[model samples]
Target: MRPKIYLFGDSITEMSFEHGGWGASLVNHFNRTVDVVLRGYSGYNTRWGLKVLDKVFAGSSESESVLAVTVFFGANDASVEDRCSAFQHVPIEEYKQNLHSIVSFLKGRWPTTEVILISPPPIDEPTRLLCPFTENKSGLPERTNEAAGNYAKACLAVAAECGVSAIDLWTRMQQIPGWQTACLSDGLHLTQTGNKIVFEEVVEALKKKGFSLETLPVDLPVIFDIDPNDPLKSFQGI
Candidate 1:
């Protein structure tokens, strides 16, 4: 069976196969070596993600072939509880618990499958104020970097506890000079450059786990490997 990379996260993950998305970038990078599967849901938090975990993995039990799974919920979980988007607000503690549940579940099911936890990217507060999640007359953003930082930290803690890998997107993105505008499109979503950062980071993390594109075994031959005299010969038994 072919090796697979599962991306389980929120809207940012859901749209990862778009033209310049990070998921698509992975697909491009891996080519025929490994398949990148998308199980992303829009506007989901760790709470909802936890509830649906079984539904996504129950039908697929090919544990050995499962290379890695990225758990990337939290942007929605960081929502302000008293705000209009409070429906998605999960307390920081609960968020950590939910993340722990997710990592534990994946590792339990796929014993060798690497679980990479990606914290939500930094929020662009001023832009969010101008374009709130909903029409909040309070003139406030539903999410903020400070609020999301708690969840991001919680994510890193969970990874450390679980002894797995993690990407501290919130902190990493903010470290850039103009990250507020450079990384996020509005307040939450990622721009092309932002997606590029995510793609690069994932590649680096996977490389550390010994899963680089150069190291992964290729499934089929490239065009150059196909013999001009007998093109079908290469694929007959593959």
Candidate 2:
């Protein structure tokens, strides 16, 4: 296959709607430079991804031609279980363990892979209210800056521990003015515009680390068939 960058994550990663997902936006922003392989699955946690790593990897080979791998997760893991479902407020330790497993699995399977860990951003309270399921989950409250920060820190620590590149989108999202309003339509998910903001920041960070769009093939197809309801879809128009 042409050079590919596989994206592994939850709904946020899979989000490719009409306007486009973060992945699509990422592709458009760098279309002149790189092509992408989308593998983001909705409602999946790091724990579950570990179980399906083989399937994920089976889609691509470990050849040097593969450009990179980006993993974006944690929103669903932090979600609160409601009405008998696994909740978001995953204990910090469990979250850490789950992430550790994912990282280890990646390293073991592709020792030479260029891995990137992207921390999920803080949720907007009103955005949370927009989703009835999330609203009903009392234990899983809207994401506070502190909680979001903690999660980012944990993710960063894990990435460092594993010696991989880390993208701290949480802090960048929080620093923006009217971030809550511009970033999220509800409390937890991003709006279309919000996703653009995310894609831009992530691309900038990647560029800083010497990842240029000029490195990948241009004929690779873009994956934009994302579900609008997906958490990552909130960033649809953005």
Candidate 3:
């Protein structure tokens, strides 16, 4: 059976297959070797995400192996309760617990599936203010770098406790000079450069776990190798 990689997260993940997006980059990198499954739900937090995990993941076949599963969320969960977008707000403690639950559940379901938790990226409050989503006057941006950092730390902690890999995007993005201007298009969403960062980091993490795209067998014979006279030869070992 073909190997699969699952991307599960919020809007950042939902839009990951767009032009110059991370998910699309992975699809290109893996090519015919693996299947990239997108299970992103825009505007959904860990609270809602946890509830729908079963619906989204359902069941896996014994013959089907999942190479990796990326759990990316916490952007909307970091929403300030008192801010305009309180609907997406999830308490920090609850957010951490939910992440633990998610990792545990996925591990239980897919014993061999590698889990990679990605922390939400930093928020640019000033740039976010310009977004129509935060039009009305409010105390602070619906989300803040500080608040998202807190969630990012919690996410990392959960990953450690759950024995899973993690990508600390919050801290990494900030380390990049002029990240505020280059990494994010608006205040929260990733720019093309930011998506490249994610794609590279994820690839690095998978490599560390011994998942090398170069080592995987091609899913089928190359089109150029398929002889028109004997097309069945192309599918012989597939």
> Of the candidates shown, which would achieve the greatest TM-score relative to the real structure?
1
Per-candidate total of colliding backbone pairs: 0, 25, 0
lDDT of 1: 0.90
Give stretches of model 2 more than 4 Å off. 16-20, 80-89, 134-145, 214-238
Runs of candidate 3 with Cα error greater than 4 angstroms are: 59-63, 132-135, 223-238
TM-score, every prediction: 0.94, 0.78, 0.92
Ranking by lDDT: 3, 1, 2
Specify the poorest-scoring 10-residue window by lDDT in model 1.
56-65
**TM-score, prediction 2:** 0.78
Q: Comparing 1 and 3 by TM-score, which wins? A: 1
**Candidate 2 lDDT tens digits, 38-86:** 8889877677777898898885655545556788877766654332234
Task: Tell me which residue pairs clash in candidate 3.
Answer: none
Instruction: Tell me the whole-model lDDT of each prediction, alpha carbons only.
Output: 0.90, 0.69, 0.91
Error of 1 at 196 (Å): 0.4
Candidate number with greatest lDDT: 3
Please, what are the lDDT tens digits per residue for candidate 3 over residues 1-238?
5799999999999999889999999999988888999999999999999999888887555457888999999999999898888899999999999999999888887888899999999999998888736454864688889999999999999999999999999999998888997899998999999999999999999999988777777776888888999989778765
Instruction: Find the 10 residues in a row with the least total lDDT in model 3.
Output: 131-140
* True-structure lDDT of candidate 2: 0.69
